[model samples]
Target: MNPELLIAFLASTAGAATPLVLAATGELVAERAGVLNLGLEGMMLVGAVMGFSVTLASGNGGLGLLAAMGAGALMALLFAFLVLTLQTNQVATGLALTLFGVGLSAFIGRGLVGQTVAPLRKLAFPVLSDLPFVGPLLFRFDAMVYASLLLTVAVGWMLARTRLGLLVRAVGESPHSAHAIGFHVIALRYGAVMFGGAMAGLAGAYMSMALTPMWVEGMTAGRGWIALALVVFATWKPRGVVLGSYLFGGVTVLQFHGQGFGLAVPSEFLSMLPYLATIAVLVYICRDPKTILLNKPLSLGQSFRAD
Candidate 1:
């Protein structure tokens, strides 16, 4: 590829990775808090539909993004009610939430199939976007890209460096212990889960309103499941999630552009590359948890009961 094409491709890769990075980071935090939400796909779909729908109606992409966040948090709250408050089966409840979000989004998006949204403004740093080729590749991006990067760093620091982070970790590792010490494990989990939901919503919204500039049924195209897989692929680490997302983005983009090189690959085979790559990564990532504690949050997918 030429310099300009390579630069453009790299830039697209970064933008494509942001949504996954943001959503996976949020999920990493929620799992770290000992909550397993399998409904991320559904939540993202709902966010995509609602975000675009609201933006089309209100003409404010920010408000639409906020609304998407609220919608995601609300769905997560429902999941919390089932698993946390009622002490239901976490896996089953999460799947239920996914089902609900899918159906709800399909219904809500019926009339929004062709609607349009005003995209969010791109954020440019002074001189940073004016640098050489690398500047165009890295500097000129929408605000969400920077926010996603900062979010990953902030989450990593929170999980590793702060007292509150300690409490959140405590809640995930051993909620009984956290509760015994007045950490309010239930509350912490809810907050984390809601954050995950909202972020997933924003990720989905980014696709419909920003990337594609319109809504479509199942527009997320399994990005949600990819995010879930990334958590395990990263061993529940924040920084790993970023690398994994970017890696996924690269493979995804390559599948589309790889044909131009005239490799001996079949078009049908190339079409399945993303899903195949996900499976390959998972197999390589967490084959054995004994050697790697990165599989997931220990308390994840469990019922937390307190006296």
Candidate 2:
């Protein structure tokens, strides 16, 4: 491949991975707190529509991003309330949340279909953005991309080094123990879940406002599920999440460019590449049960009652 083309491919891969990085990082935090909220698709969809609609009406991408995070966080709060307060089954409630988000987003976005808004502007550093190949590769992405990288590092540092990370890990590993020790397990989990939702929403907003700059029903196209898979693929580690997200992102970008590269494969098969790679990676990962058993939060997916 030509040097410039290779640079573009790398750049596109980074952009493609940004949403996954954001969503998966958030999900990792929630799961680390032992809350397995699986409604990421719903949250992302709602966020996408909300971001698009808000940006269109207000003509401000910043507000649109904030609205998207709020929307996602609200949806997550609903999930947290049901599972935490009501003691509902986490899996069932999460699935239901996804369904609700999908329908709700479709309804809210009904009028906004086919509408277009200016894509979020990429941040440019003075001399940095103008450098030959390095500039476009490193400095030309929108703000969210940089934010995703920073968020990943922040989450990793917190989980590994901070006292708060220890508490969250303690809650995830043994909520009863954490609660017995005077840590508010329920409250901690709630915060983690809401954070996850906000991140998922931000990812969705990026899809609408920056990635494609338009709204379409089901525009998230199952990236939410992919993000869910990403957590497992990363073995609940932030660094692993970043690596896995970028790998998947590369797959996603490759599928888009497969035909352009003159591969004789059908576009339909090419479209399946990212998902297919996900399944393949998961199956491979699952082959070693110890890898999962050792890394997964012990209290994950279990509802806790303070009684």
Candidate 3:
């Protein structure tokens, strides 16, 4: 490919992967704390609508991103209350959250369906952005792209280096032991879940305000599900999540650009590339039982009653 085409492809790949990175990284944190939040899709939908509405009304992308986080955290708070406090089934409650988000976002977003907002402006380095090859590849993205990368690194450091990270890993590995040692298991899980929700929400906002800059019902499509699968594919590691997200992002962008490259495949088949690759990756990663057993949080999806 030409330098220009390569630059565009790389740029688009990062944009496509940004939301996944944010959502999966958040989910990774929660999972590490022994909580499984399956409502990612719902949280993202709510965030997308909330961000779009706020940005459109206030014309402030930053505020829109904040609103999206709040909306996502609110949804997550509900999930935490049910699963952690009320002892509801994690799977059922998460699925319900997704359903609720879909219905609620659609209800509120009906009026704003066809409206558009100015896409979030890119933050470019002066001379660096003007460089021939690596410039557009690295420097022309909006703030969220950079934020996602930073978030990933931060999460990795927190999980690997911090004392809090040790507690989180212990809680995930065996909450009973952590509890015996005086950690508040429920509180920690709640914090993780809320953080996950906030990140997922920011990701959704990135979709509406930056990626597409429009509102459509179910606009997240299956990206939320893909993000969930990405967590498993990454074996709950922060760096793995980033790599997996970017890989999927490349697949997603490639399908769109396939026609431009004179590929003979049908557009429909090309569109399935991302999802199909997701399934392939899941199967490949999961076929090894040891990988799942060794990496997955031991107390993941289990209800922990402090009594």
Report lDDT (CA) for all predictions.
0.86, 0.93, 0.92
Residue 220, model 1: Cα distance from true site in angstroms: 0.7
lDDT of 3 by residue, 69-115 (tens): 99999999999999999999999999999999999999989999899
lDDT value, candidate 1, whole model: 0.86
Report the number of the highest-TM-score candidate. Answer: 3
Off by over 4 Å in 1: 262-264
**Residue range 1-307, candidate 1, lDDT tens digits:** 5677677667778878988997899899899999989999999999989889888988988888999999999999998888999989988887888888888999999887776776777878898889999688888888888899899999999899998788888888888888887888888899999999999999999988777889898888889889998998888999899999998887777666666545678877876877899998877765775635754567877778889
**Model 3 TM-score (2 dp):** 0.98
What's the CA RMSD of model 2 in angstroms? 1.0
* Candidate 1: RMSD to truth: 1.6
- How would the candidate models be sorted by lDDT, starting from the highest? 2, 3, 1
Query: What tens digits encode model 2's per-residue C-alpha lDDT throughout 1-307?
Result: 5777678778989988999999999999999999999899999999999999999999999999999999999999999999999999999999999999999999999999999999999999999999999999999988888999999999999999999999999999999989998999999999999999999999999999999999999998989999999999999999898999899998888877776666799888878988999899889999999977757999999989986
Model 2: colliding residue pairs: none
lDDT of 3 at 32: 93
Superior by TM-score: candidate 1 or candidate 2: 2
Decide which is better by lDDT, 2 or 3.
2
